[model samples]
Target: MVDIKSWIFKDCCLVFSLLCISIVGITTGDQEVLTNSWLVELSEGGEAAARDIAKRAGFSYVSPVLGSDTEFHFIHNAVPKTRFRRSILHTRKLKSHPFVKRAVQQTGFVRSKRGYKPLKGVLLSDLHINNPEIGQLINDEKDVVIGKDPTDPLFDKEWFLKNRGQSGGIKGLDLNVEAAWGMGFTGKGVTTAIMDDGIDYLHEDLKYNYNSEASYDFSSNDHFPYPRYTDTWFNSHGTRCAGEIAAARDNDVCGVGVAYDSKVAGLRMLDQPFMTDLIEANAMGHMPNIIDIYSASWGPTDDGKTVDGPRNLTMRAIVKGVNEGRNGKGNIYVWASGDGGQEDDCNCDGYAASMWTISINSATNDGQTAGYDESCSSTLASTFSNGKSTIRDAGVATTDLYNNCTTTHSGTSAAAPEAAGIFALALEANRNLTWRDMQHLTVLTSKRNRLFDPYLKHFWQYNGAGLEFNHLFGYGVLDAGAMVYMANHWKPLPERFHCTAGSIKKEMNFGTNEPITLTIDTDACKGTDNEVNFLEHLQAFVTVKSSYRGNIVMHLTSPMNTTSMILSQRPNDDEHKNGFTRWPFMTTHTWAEAPRGTWTLRVENIAGKNNEYDDGLFREWTLVLHGTRDPPYHHQDADEENQTKLFKVKRMHDMAMKN
Candidate 1:
C-alpha cells in the first residue's frame, strides 16, 4: 500500500510538471494576450443573455468559468471579436447596460487594416535604381558628389574629431575623439550582431570593422554577406545600419560611427527589403555565440495588439535567448521601437514591448528642423543623426554600402543602432554585468534634464519629473558619459522576500498573546559576501490580523560572520525623503546596515484583534522591497582581465549544464 501511494505521488508530480510546461509555452508566445477584452463572466440570470450577445456579435466561440460574485469568466476568441462596424455599435450599446458591468476590447492579436507594401525600386530593383538621378544632380560637382571642401563652415569638424576623422563629417566639424576616448567606450573587443538585410562587407569604410570570422548570411545560408547587385536593384539598409554602429574610425576616409573601435557581426535575415520568418528562425538558431549585443532595427507596426503568425517562432527563439540562452548569462537584445509616431500612438505594443528587449526610439540631429520632432521629456536620446539627407537618419554620416558618403536618412531604425553602440561602450566598461543590470543602470543614469524641451507641454504630461522617462523621450536622451559613470558603479537590486504562513488560503490559528515566529526568505539573495548589503536594497512592512501593528526582528547567518540583532517597530512615520535612501516602513528596515549572508526575518504580532485568535481572523499583508547596487569604480581599470575571466567561467558553467 505504501509503495502504491509513492507511485501515485510521483505520477502526480509528473503531471504537474507537464502542466507547468504547457502554461509557460502558452504565456510566452510571440502573440501574447495584450488586453482583457476576451474575458467575460456570466451572471446567474444573465447567462443566456451573455451567450446571445456573443453569438449575435459573431464571436464563433465561448467558454465558461466561475469568478467573483459580481464577475465571472466567459472566454471567447482572444482577439477582437466584433467586426469594425459591429465594434462601434457594441461599444455604444454596452454603455447602456447597468448589469453588463463593463465591456472592453480584447487584444491578443494585431489587427492591420492594410497589408505590408514593399519599397518599390529601392529594395526590389537591381543595381542603383537612383544612380541616374543622383548622377544628374551631382554631375562633376565634386563638392556635391563628395562634400564641401575640408574648410567648409557647414562641415561638422566636431563630429569629425569625435569620430577620430574616420567618418566623413562636414568639412570643419570638430571631432572630440579625446572626450569620447576618455570615457573608455572605444567599443574595442565588443561584437555587435546585426540581424537585418545583407550588408556590403566589402564597403571600404566598413570592411575593416567587420568580424569576417563571425559574420553569416542566414538569409541564403551562403558566405556572401553583401547586398546582391542584381540588374539595377540593391537594398543596403542592413549595410548602412552596420556602418553606423561600428564603422572603422580615424581612417581619414569616409564617415564616422558611434563605436568606431567595435567589431561588427552582420547576420542577414532579410532579403533586400522583405522580411522572412524562416530566415529569422535560422539566424536565431545560430546566435548563441560570444555576441555582446544584438541590434535589430525592425519590428511589426505597433497596432495596439501583439502580432501573430508563423513568424512568431522567431520572436519566441529571441525570447529564449533572452531568458535562458547563452547558458543563462543573458544577452542584450536591442530593437528599434518603431517609426510610426506620426499617426499611430508611440506606445503601441509589439516585439519591443517584450520585457527581454530594450526598445529604442529615434531623435533628429540638434540642427534638423523637420520630421517627427517630439520633445524628449521622458526618455534619453541614445544617439544623434542628420535627418533625411542620406537614408535612415541620413544626416548622420556613416559608411554607405556602396562606399558612397551620403547623409539623408531618418527613422527609429537608425536610432536603435546608435543606442546599441552606447550599450557596447557600457559593456566594454564592465563585461561582468548582466543585461538586466545594464538596462536598469542605463535608464537610471540617463541625462533627463538635457533632453527636456519646456516648449512642448503635451509631451511632458507622462514624464515623471519633466526629466526622466517621458512618453516621447523614454528616459530623456541617452548620455554616453553618464552611462559610463553608472557602469562603473551599477549593482542589482535585492529580490523580494516571500513571507507566508505556508499556504495563503489555509487558515492558521494563533491565540491571543501566542507568539508565532513568521519567517521570511528572499529568493534573490545570493548569500555571498559580495551580496552582503542585499538587505539594504529592500523595504518591507508587516501586518497582523489585518492591522499593521507588529514588531519585526531580523537575523542573518553566513560563512563569513553572523549579523547583530536588529528590530523595527510598526508605524514608521519617516516618509522616504532621501533620493538614495530606501523608505522606512512602519515596521521595516533595510539590510544595508546589517551583515550579509543567509538571513531570516521574524514578525511578532504585538497587538491586534482577537485576544483569543481564531484561524479565520488571520489576513495577508503586502511587503514591498527595492534594492540595487552601483558597479564598482575599480572595475573600469580591471575590465579586460575581469571580463575575460568572468566570460570563461560563465561559458564553462553553461557547457556543463548542457552536458
Candidate 2:
C-alpha cells in the first residue's frame, strides 16, 4: 500500500535508505518490480506468443520491446527465473532454453541449415524497475536550479506544481515546474489563442494579461471573447483554460498558471452550436503571427464512437498556420487529447490526432492515469489533471465566469491549456522555435513512462531515433523545467516532407469470421521532393458502411511491425452510423521509422454480428507519410527546426509504392 517511489527520496535527495530498501527488497525477497528485470529478445513471437513464452519461462510479461512482434521482453518476478518466482540479483545470465526464435518475418530472413540460429543478446543495466521516467541519460550542461516558491497564500494547495502527498496527491509527481519557475520563465511575452467557447477576461486572475487584439468571439461578432453564460454554467470552460495558461501570479484570486506571465487571447466558437469547416479554419488561423499558440479544449464528441476531423478548409488552414505562421516560424497548436475514458481512442478525433497539433492528455494528482483517459500512438505528452474519482479532489482551480474562481476544472480540457501555458514559457525562453522545434522539445524533455501510472502497456519503447514511448502515457508526463531548459538552447528542425500511397476502394463483409488486412507498398515515397526516410505522422483515410459501428476494431501496422490501435470497438457506440467516412486516422507510432516495404492495415468486425448491413464497404483507402529524409537518401540536416532549409528531399529508399 506504500508508494515505493516516496521511500526513494529523503531529505531532498535519493538517499541510501530508499536505495537500500529497493536493493534489499530485490536481493532478499520476491519483490515483483525489482526481481522482474530481464532483457529478452524472441526469435519469433507476437504479444500473445510472448505472453505464453513468459508464462512458460516463469516470468511476468510487461510488454514487447517497443511493440516488436519479433522480440519478447518480460520481467523475472521470482528468483533465478523459476516458474512464477523469478530473481535478478541471484542470477547474472538468463537461460532462454525454451524461449528461442518465435519471430515470424513477413519478407522472411535467412534460415539456418543446422536447425540452430545464433541467438543475439544484450543487457540494459541501468533501467529502473518499471519506471522509465525516473530520468534519462541526458548530457545537460545547464544547472537545474529551482526558483523560490511563489508567494501566493494558497500556493501550497496547488499540488500540481509542488506535491507532497496533499489530498491523495503524489509528491514530486506534478508537472516538474519548480525548476522552470526558478529560471524566471513565467511566459513573459508569448500569447496563447483559446479556440473554445469563451473566456472571463474581467476575472481578477486573468484580466490584465488578456490580449484584446488577438481575442475574438466567433460565435458572436464581439471584439472581446468574454464568457457569456446565463444558462450553461460550465460555459466558463474557456476562461478556466485561459486561467490555467495565464492566470495572475502574486496577486492571485485563484491559483497561478503554468505560464503566469503569459498573455491569453480567447477565440470563442464552440458556443455557436453549429460550426462549419470555414468557421473552424478561421478559428485555427485567427491571428497567425499574433497568436503564438492555439489552445483548444474541445474536439469531436468523446462518446467513444464519433469519428470526426476537420473538413477541407480547416485542414488547409491548419497546414497554413503551421507553415506560414509566426513569420514563417510555424504557429503552434495545443489540443486536448479527449476525455473519452478507456473505451475511446484519440485516433477517432481528427483534431487531437492531427499531425500539426500537439495532442495533450491528462494525468492525475495521485500520479495515476485519469479514469477518463483515452489512448493513441499520436499522444505526445500528458499533464496533471483531475482524477475521475468523486471521492477525491484532483480537479484544477482556475477563474470562473461571474468574476468568481472555481477549483473544479478537470479532464483533458484543462490539460491542454496547461501545456499551452508551459509551451508559452518555453517559447519565451526561445523565440525562434518552429512548430517542429516545439515537438522535438516535447519528445526530448517530456518525461517518459513513469511506473507510477501502472497502466502502461510497455515500460519503454525506442523510436527510430531511440526515443522512449509508452502506450498509455505516450512519451511521458510534461517536464516544464526540462522543456524550458531545452527550449533555451533548442535548434531548428528540417523542413516538412510528404509522401503518399495509392487510394484503393475496398469493401468488407460484415459476416466474415476472419480479420482482413489491406497491404500497400511505398515505392512512390522515393520522389524528388516527397521522399521520406523516417516518419512523423502516418494518416489513413477510410470509408465504410456499417450497421453497428462499434463492432469494428481496426489496427494499422507499419513495416517495422509497430501496431497502432487506430479504432477500437467502442461498446457505447452502438448506433448505426456511416463508419469511417473518409475519416483520417493518424498515428505517431512510426516516428523516426523508415517508410518502406509493405505496410499492412488490419480491419475486423469483432462482434461478427450476422445482421442486416453486416457487410461493409471500404469505399476507398489512402495513406500519407510525413517525415524527414533519413541518411543515405539525401544530405541530412541535424537542425530539426530550421525551416529556412527546406531539406534535401532526396529518396532514402526506392518507395516502390503499391508493388
Candidate 3:
C-alpha cells in the first residue's frame, strides 16, 4: 500500500513552507506597522534568478504560493516590523527587479462563516410547545426498511437524511440517501475536507473517519486542526459540518453521517484574526489528490451591502484545483450560498456566483425555503436546514464540540455538508467523475420532488432544456439515490470549451422606469477550435454606472428564450461611487442550451417609489459561453434516456400545478 495520507502530507510540505508572518498594515491599539511578508511573483523560468535577487536584498525566500509555480512568499526577519513608507519602498524595489514580475506587501481581509447565527429563530425561548402537528410521524412500515438503520440515538431526529414527518416535517421530503446506502455506496474511498474554523477529530463519532495526514491548521501553523476553545462554542462550526459528512455509523453517539464510511479532513484556516490570501490559497489547494471534496460554508459577509469574492491568489488556487487536481479529474468545491434572506442577493457574492463552485442553498424539512436562504440564479441546489414553526422546531442533527451532539446545526452551513456527503457517495460510485461531471449529475439527478418557496418569493420553472429550476432551490433538493444510480453508468463529458460571443463597448443611458435592453448574436465561435455550441455556463461580464446601485435589476435571456435573473435589487446596497465593473454575473439556467442565436440582456431600475437617484448608464458588457462542441450526452445510454423520462414526468407535474 502507498500510505496515501503520508504521501499527501510530504507532497504538501515539499512545496509549501510555513511563514511566520504577522498582519500587515493593521492597526493594533493605535500603532500601525507593516509585516515582513511579501507576495512575490517571478517571471516564467526565473526561479533561480529570483532566489538570487531575494538573497541579495536580504529577504529569505519562502515556499511557492500553494497552487502557482512562479508566485512565492518572501520575508525579511531582520527588519520584521517597519513603517509603511519603508515597506512600500521595499515593494517598489522588488517590483523593479529584473527577475520579479510583481511584488506586494500582504494584506488581510475578513471572511465570515455563512451562518453566524446558528439558532437564528429557533432559540429555546422562542420554541413552541404542546402543538398537535409538532409530534414525530410514526413509521408504519416496520419490516420493510429501505436501508439498514443505524443504532445512533439521534438518527431518527436527522430528518434531512430520512424524514418520516419528524418534527412536523412532510414525510419523504429529504435527501433520499437511504436507498443509495442500501445499494452499498457509502462513500467508502472518498475524503471530504471541511475548510472551516476547525474540526474536533477526537470526537467519538468523527475520530474513526478523521484523516489526520491530510489535515492542517493554517491559522496556527500546526498539523492538528483542533478548534480553539471558547465558552460560547462558536468554533464548533467545522466539527458540526464534519459530522454531517463522515460521522461513524451505528456508533451510539450521534446521528450517522451522510457518507458514514468516508473520511473527513480538517483545514483550520478560519479561526484566525484575519484571512490572508496565502492562507486561503493553501487551504483550497491542500491535498487535492487525496481530498476529493472541499466543503466551504464561509464567504464574504452576507450583508446585502457588500459585493466581493475570491481575491487574486485564491482565484488562481480554485482555477488550479479545477484544472489540475485529482489527476486532472478536478477537485469538487461545494459552497454555501449566503444566508442574507430576502434582503440579500447571492449574485452579489462572488464565491457562490462563480461557475467553478456548486453553491448550495437551504430548505426546510417540509420542503420550503428557509427564512435565511438568499436567492440567486447561481445556486446549483439546496439541502435541508432548520425550519421552525408554531408546529415544531426542526434543525439539522450532528456532532458538536467536546464530544457533544447537537440537534440544531442550522443555516446554510449545515446544508452544504449534506451536499458534500452526497457528492462523496457519487465519487465513490465512479472515481473517474470530474468536477464538471458531478455538476452534470446534480442537474440531472436532483429532483424538485416536493420542494417549494412557500412565500412564493421564487417559483420553479422549466428552462429551455425542460429541466426545472428555482432561484431558491436551483434544480431542486439533491436526490442521493438518483445521483449514485446515474453515476454508476456515467460517461465523462467531452473536453470543455469557451468563447466570447460578443461585447458592447459604448455606454447606453436609461432612466429609472425605462429598461435597457442589449442583444448579442453569434454562432458561439463556430468554425473555430474554441467553439461552444452547447451552453453549460454563461457569464455576462458587465460594467454599469448607477446613482443608487441597489435599484439595479438585470436579467439574461438565452438564445433558447430561457430567461435568468442574473442580478436582483439589493435593498441594502446603496453604493453609487464604483458601480459594477466587469463583474461576471453567471448562471447555469441555460445548461445544455444551444448558444448560436441572439441573446438578450435586460437591465431595469426597480427604483419604484423610492428613486433616491436620477439615472443609470450601462457602460460595457461581454457575453462568454462555456460548453463542449459536441453534445455532452453523446453516449445516450439507458441512464440518460431514463433521466429524460423523469424530466418529462416533472414537466407534466409542473403544468398541472400551474393549472
Candidate 4:
C-alpha cells in the first residue's frame, strides 16, 4: 500500500527544503538536543490554517514572527527517542501541511558585542576624568557658539558634540550638532531602537525619552528590557549607547544626547545563553512602523577569522523591513563597523558590508583614525570615538547602569549610536525620507573637514564624481548640521535600480607575488529598464580559495580611475579549509561614479618576504551596480545631463535600426 520509492522521493524534497535550517552543535546541560522550536513560513493570510496544522501535528502555536506577517514560530513538547527521527518526522509533517511554505529548526550562533576590549597599556579609569584644560579650551573658543547650550555638567567634556581643541585634540573636529541644535532640531518626533544587551530605561537621564512600546526582551521573552545587574557591570553597554542618543538635555545628568528630545527604545536580544535566527529577526523587525531607526553595534566575532552574518529568518526580516517598514518609507539601519582593528576586515563581516546598512566608522577627536580602526571601503561615514591619548577624556560620555553616568564609553559601538542620534534629528526634520534617502544625505552632507589617516596608509582621493573618500574614513566625518539642513531641503531620490554588469564563472589560479587582474567593460546596462547611469553602491560577489585567506587582497578600480580597496589584508584570517564563496564585498568609495567604463579588479597574495603559501584559486567574480538612470543630486552640471540624454537617444535609435 505504501509506495516506498515515491515516499523516498518526497522525503528527499522535504529534506532539501529543510536545509534552510541552520545546523550547529548546540549542547544543553551537557546533552546535545534540539531546542524543539521551529520557524515556519506559511502562505500569506494563513494564520488560522497554521494554527490548525500545528494542532494536528501535536505542536503548540507561538506568536507570529515579530517582524514577518507570513512567518510564525511554533513549539513542540513531544520528545521522540531519537533526535534525528523526530526532526525527519516533523519536517515531513510540516511540509505536508497545505499552508506551510517552509520550515526550519532554529539553532544558535555566537554574536559578539562590538565594544573594544582593553588594550595592553590603556587604563579605562583614565578616560573617566575630564581634563581641566577642556573647560579652558571651550572658554577660549567663544567665537564657536551654540545657542543656549545645555547646562549638563559633562556638556563641556562632550567634545564630540562641539570639539574646540580640548585635551590634546584638534579644534572643530566634531559632529557639528551644535549648529543643528541652534536651528531648533532636537530630534523631536523620532524613535530609535537600541538592539543590544539591554537599556537602563529607568535611569534619570534616559527615563524621560524612553519608549516602552517599542521595547522588548527576546532573551527572556518579556517586555521589560532593563539590563540585568551584575557586579562587573557587563551589561551597561546598551545604557551608554542610549544616553548617547536620547539622554535628556539640561537635566544636570550626563552630557546632552545628540538628539536629546528623541525617543529611545530597548530591544534586548543579546543577553541570552545563545543567539538564534528567530531572535535576531524579531529584534530587527520589531515595531518597524513605530521605530524609525534600528541602531546595531554588534556583529560576528571581530577576531579577523570568523566570517558570519544574518541567517535565513534574520536576512528575510531585514529585507522586509527595508521594503515594507516605516509605512514603506523604509527603516534606517545603522551598523557599527567591526572593531577588529588591523586584524579584521569589515567586508568579511556581512552585516557591516551589506548594502542595506549604513556602515559607520570611528574617528578620533584629533581628526585621525584610531589605532584599532579597521580599513574597509564599505564604511559610509565617520563618527567620533575614543583616542589613544590619556591626557584628555578619550571616551564618549553617556549614561551607565543603576542611575550612574560614565565618560568612558568607547569603540565603534559608541560611534554608531552617535550617527543614529544624528539621523534621528534629520528624521524629525523630514519624516518622509526613505532609507536610501538617509544614505544619500549622508554621502552629500558628510565633510572631509580635517579627517585623515594618521598612519598615512590610506589617503583621501576623489572619485569619478569628485567626491573624496578613504578606506579608513569613508566619505568623511558626519556633519550633523549639514545633514539636518540637507534633510530639510531634500527631495526623494529616484526609484532605485540595480544592474548585473558582468560575471566570470570560470576558475583561475594565481601564484604568490604574481597578481591577477580582471576587467569588465560594461555600459551599466544601457538602454534597458535596469540601466544605472549613476552609481550609489557597487558590489563584487567573489568566490575564491586561498591557502592563507588573510593574505588575499582585492582592489576595485572604477571607470573614473578611482581605486577602492574593497578587501584589505587581514593578518588573522587564516581560514584555509574554505575560502570566500560568493561573498559580496561592497564599497562606497566609488559612490556616484559612472558604471559604464572598464572596471578593473586586481586580486593578489602578498605572502610577505618568505613566500609562505602556495597558489590560490579565484573561482568567480560578479559585479552588480545599484543606482538610478537620472542623476540623484542637483549639483550635476547641465552639460553632463545633456550628454546623458544624447547618449540615451542615440542608443535607442541604434536599437530601433537593428530591429
Model 1 residue 135 CA deviation in Å: 37
TM-score of each: 0.50, 0.71, 0.85, 0.85
lDDT of 1 by residue, 82-139 (tens): 2322344444354345456665544332222111122221121121221111112121
The runs of at least 3 residues in candidate 4 whose Cα sits more than 4 Å from the true structure, single-residue gaps closed, are 1-36, 43-45, 48-60, 66-69, 75-102, 116-146, 608-610, 635-659
Q: Tell me the TM-score of model 2.
A: 0.71
Candidate 2 residue-wise lDDT, 144-168, digit = tens: 4423455544455567777767767
Q: Which runs in model 3 stand beyond 4 Å of their true positions? A: 1-36, 42-62, 67-69, 74-86, 89-102, 118-146, 389-393, 634-642, 645-659
lDDT by residue (157-268, candidate 3, tens digit) is 7889888897989989999787678667898989999999999999888999999999999766679999998767879899989999999987677778999999999999
**Candidate 1 local lDDT, residue 297:** 71
TM-score of 4: 0.85
Query: Highest lDDT: which candidate?
Result: 3
Clashes of 3: 0
